[model samples]
Target: MIWNENIECASRDSMSQLQTERLIRTVKRVYHDVPYYRKKMQEVGLVPEDIRTLDDLVKLPFTTKTDLRDNYPFGTFAVPMSEIVRIHASSGTTGRPTVVGYTRNDIAMWAENVTRSLCMAGVTKNDLVQVAYGYGLFTGGLGLHYGTENLGASVIPISGGNTQKQIQLLQDFGSTVICCTPSYVLHIAEVLEEMKIDASSLKLRVGIFGAEPWSENMRRDIEKKLKIKAIDIYGLSEVMGPGVSCECTHQAGMHINEDHFIPEIINPETLLPVEPGEVGELVFSTITKEGIPLLRYRTRDLTRLIYDKCECGRTLVRMEKCKGRSDDMLIIRGVNVFPSQIESVLLEMSETEPHYLIFVEREGNLDTVKVQVEVQEQFFSDEIKELQNLTKKIKYKLESTLGISVTVQLVEPKTIERSAGKAKRVIDNRKI
Candidate 1:
């Protein structure tokens, strides 16, 4: 993987030209090294020579989550296991876990992407980073860790548990930066408030959060609560891990490391590339990776792509906050919806907490979605009718925002699960 630190600032025409060259190389590599990709390409009448330019990428076959699952273990690995240095995988909640292999160069490439993300977030060697994301097969912890290290910053690898110890380290070590999921950060803020800890007194300055979809409203809440700048980071286990792109200090949008990874927005139904600034499924192709290289891997995440230069002087392409996944999208009574939409609306209501669940079901040939909300006493009035009115208000707000009617069931505080880690927002029962 070539880590040209200046690629982000490279001219647009030059970046596209570089992408074309890398695409040609990646196409040849996948077609020659991986049998699965070769078969798929053959089915689509695609050959290495067929992909001569960036536009020719559409001629290649699109990869999917199912492809990774069908390949299982290392079936899709471009290199032998001996050459691979690291392994990461999806949670496989829907089916068998889709695993990814990384060679030394691949690992270096991933670290470089993460490092670039940190640089975009204004993290430097002088900052003390506290990584609160989970370790293990999950890539959040180590991804951010290696990136921070790559930037020559001091990292405290407090991998996601023991909130008190995490705080103590933040206070005692004077950690200046934090990384974790946005919901987990909010939970930590709550704990800090409970323990009467002064977050303003803490040395924390910025937080990079990802692994799940969030909204700008949520960002404002997190920044206000923690008294730190909250930036968004995005990645998936399929492509690499957390650090494919990140928000700049300007907070415009996440800048994709276009030199290493090629991003395309494609229509979900047709699997064809969409025009810039249009919403569609995100696809990625690893250019500088050596291990388990992917070509046109369809990341179900939905977002728009921007080609304008960022205020930070990086000319790399930018992507908006992921709206939802193509597969994760739900249709009820001709209404299209997403879990993140429900979560966003829930977070806005003063009567509610971040803890909630979306129950999707098929009742009598009709799709049903019930949003379970936790009501707080702060907004919960003494009169039962007033509390009922508050519930209606929440439902009306959600309906207006989501453009779909949802049954909002208000429950007692702490009745639903509370986590110092990632919050599970959906209890989907409609299994395909």
Candidate 2:
């Protein structure tokens, strides 16, 4: 099947009509197949016929993470068990895992979306793609895996961990592209330096990093260290995994797969749509979804949208890299703090590494925020006085940058836990 061709180059009216038609069909499918969706539509006094066009979607109830969790394993599934080819779930740190099902066609659609993402990233059939994301229920690994193969490239499914082996594969296999989280890329760069390996000699030309928010400064740092261009990929398992949107070679922002997925931004509190260029929670509507079609699923990911045509010649709507999540935002002493902000400051500090944990706790009536940083190996000295001086410098710099008092604890190098999958960079103890 041909994936929507006009998606990246169509006029606005053309895209809207395509979305409306798909939305009508998806609404009818959900109303007939998914019991949960039927109940939801009934609760809102909305029948499938009530939704005539894309504009009418706002009148429908929005789906949330809680909705997916409430459904559990197969409650939201629209197809029969025999039709489902595979299942994936979220990390489930919150509660019951949010499950997703894919049919044979759904799998092919996933591959097509990922192939489009790679094309945006300038990947070609001749390139050797090295996938470093963790495989399993996590969508990052297999998402890129299918995409690389679909794009007709040689794929090395070197899913995360084993930094040394990852480097070796880059050298031996002549990998031209890599996909992993941004921090892991930095960690691999540090390992390469220790092994006296030259980054340019590895033959890696592009790096696609996501699964967490990162800054442009961090992107520049990764590019400098790995001697490659860095592109961002965005997705959630609930919204069909890592290839829902991707950065174009233009490097402005990520282009949403507007043909298959409708993107909207809304105020978290009011649930009213926000104007473009304004930051708000993102809501996704799966237009061509088969097993589980989501209608206006509240992502809680804070980002802005761009409607202008990209330099890469794709007309798909672009979304800015997420600034942070509403649920993950930390409030300490009446100040809103995001881990990404702290990470930016750490990257600017020459004496610090990317590994740091935020300790947020309540001391009596006041909330205290402490940033624990591991000293860089090259900067680590045997003298205790030197370490103390380093801690003082970090604390002073953080205070000046964040405009908030924070205690800085300097630990020995390689002390913080290195995550094989998603890096846990923040530990909030206030709830405890």
Question: Where in model 2 is the C-alpha error above 4 Å?
Answer: 1-5, 329-432
Candidate 2 residue 217 Cα shift, in angstroms, is 0.9
Worst 10 residues of 1 by lDDT: 328-337
What lDDT tens digits, residue by residue, belong to model 2 across residues 109-166?
8998999998888889899999998888778899999988998999999998788899
lDDT, model 1, position 362: 52
> Which pairs of residues collide in model 1?
none
In angstroms, the error of model 1 at 308 is 0.6
Residue 123, model 1: Cα distance from true site in angstroms: 0.7
Steric clash pairs (candidate 2): 8-315, 132-160
TM-score of every candidate = 0.77, 0.77
Root-mean-square deviation of candidate 2: 11.8
Worst 10 residues of 2 by lDDT: 329-338
Residue ranges of candidate 1 with Cα displaced over 4 Å: 1-5, 329-432
The whole-model lDDT of each prediction reads 0.81, 0.83
